[model samples]
Target: MTTKVLVAYGTTNGSTARIAETVAEVLDKEGLTAEALPARTVTSVWSYDAVVVGGALYTGRWHRDARRFVRRHREDLAARPVWLFSSGPLDPSASERDIPPVPGVVRAMARLDAQGHITFGGCLQEGARGRVARMILRSGKGGDFRDFARIEDWARTIAADLTADVRAGWL
Candidate 1:
């Protein structure tokens, strides 16, 4: 059977969802079966061989749905090869450097024993929710900062890691 991967994400303003989709697309191109779904909609992770959980960062905290998803499916996630990602920096810092996970994500990584984690640049365009988001947009701080090339590169790394595991009889 092909290795199936679930790319679950918690996004605000729909930007992180696009990032999740990109990841799934890259994995699919790399000969893996992958699907991108909203974290709140995924009732179970047991059907997949691996998972990639992503969340939007807001004020240094991960999206609530992503945190809840990890908490709700902790046991199943622990048994699988899991990776995590956060996308929330409005600047180019994420693409320019290694932005570490927020405290909550760090804890989740430890609990799930996730294979790896990455932080991607975030996007905040027009019509974003929340008063703060609106303010940021009005102040001209909101823009699409997500780097698709970087996102794809990360997904390729994941595919390589999974492929390696399969060849070594580890997955």
Candidate 2:
């Protein structure tokens, strides 16, 4: 049987959306039916067999909509397999450090019984916003630091887990 997967994301400068799309592509290639949609578009979790929800980080927090999405769908998400991802931390130096996951993300994970959570680097457009926004953008130490290969590998792992569940008649 085919598994329907929803790859939903919240983005600011759009890096998170790209990450979600890449994950959806990987899942599709793995023979799962997957679609990447904005978090706001997901009205209900009942339509999907599995869900991958992602968001961009700002001021060390996840986008508000993504947090709200998790809070709103916590019960339905707990009844199904779910994964979470955050796109931020453009600083390569910080990549090796173990910062605690964003607070909203932590709550979502606990509430949803999320299968996994991953954090990836994000980008910033030059001179796009004001001083504070620019400062935060600069502090992340600007760069298109996303590792597509790693992202694809993670997607494959998620697909493998879901596929195993399907074969076992547990999905």
Candidate 3:
């Protein structure tokens, strides 16, 4: 059977969902069966051979749905090859440098023994929900900072690692 992967994400403005979809697309192209879904909609991770969890950073905190998903599926996640990602920084910093995961993500990484974690540039455009988002937009700070090339490169790396493990019978 093909290795089935789940790319689950929590997003307030939908930027993170797009990232997750990109990841799933890459994984599928790499010969793995993958799908992207909203974190809150998933009831379990058992059917997936591996999982990639992503969250949007808000006010220095990971998105609530992602946090809850990890907390709820810790056991299943720890048993498989899992990865984590966070999309937040409203600037080009994420693309320019390797931004570390937030504290909560770091802790979850340890607990779930995630294979890897990455921080990608965030996107905040007009019509984004929340007062802070509107305020940021009014302040002339809202823009799409996500680097698709970087995101694709990261997804490719993950595909390589997972495919290698599969060949070695580790997945």
Residue-by-residue lDDT tens digits, candidate 3, 1-171:
589999999999899999999999999999999999999999999999999999999988899999999999999999999999999999999999998998999999999988899999999999999999999999999899999999999999989998999999988
lDDT of 1 at 72: 97
Off by over 4 Å in 2: 93-100, 127-131, 136-140
**Model 2 poorest ten-residue lDDT run:** 91-100
State TM-scores per candidate.
Answer: 0.98, 0.91, 0.99
Q: Which tens-of-lDDT digit does each residue in 1-171 have in candidate 2?
A: 899999989987778999999999999999999999999878998989999999988888898778878888888889999999988877653255444578888888888889989888776767645576588657765678787888898899999999999999999
Measured over all alpha carbons after superposition, the RMSD of each candidate to the real structure, in angstroms, is 0.6, 2.1, 0.6
Cα displacement (Å) at residue 59, model 2: 1.1
Which residue ranges in model 1 land beyond 4 Å of their true spot? none
In candidate 3, what residue range of length 10 has the lowest lDDT sum? 162-171
Worst 10 residues of 1 by lDDT: 162-171
The lDDT values for all models are 0.95, 0.86, 0.95
Clashes of 2: 0
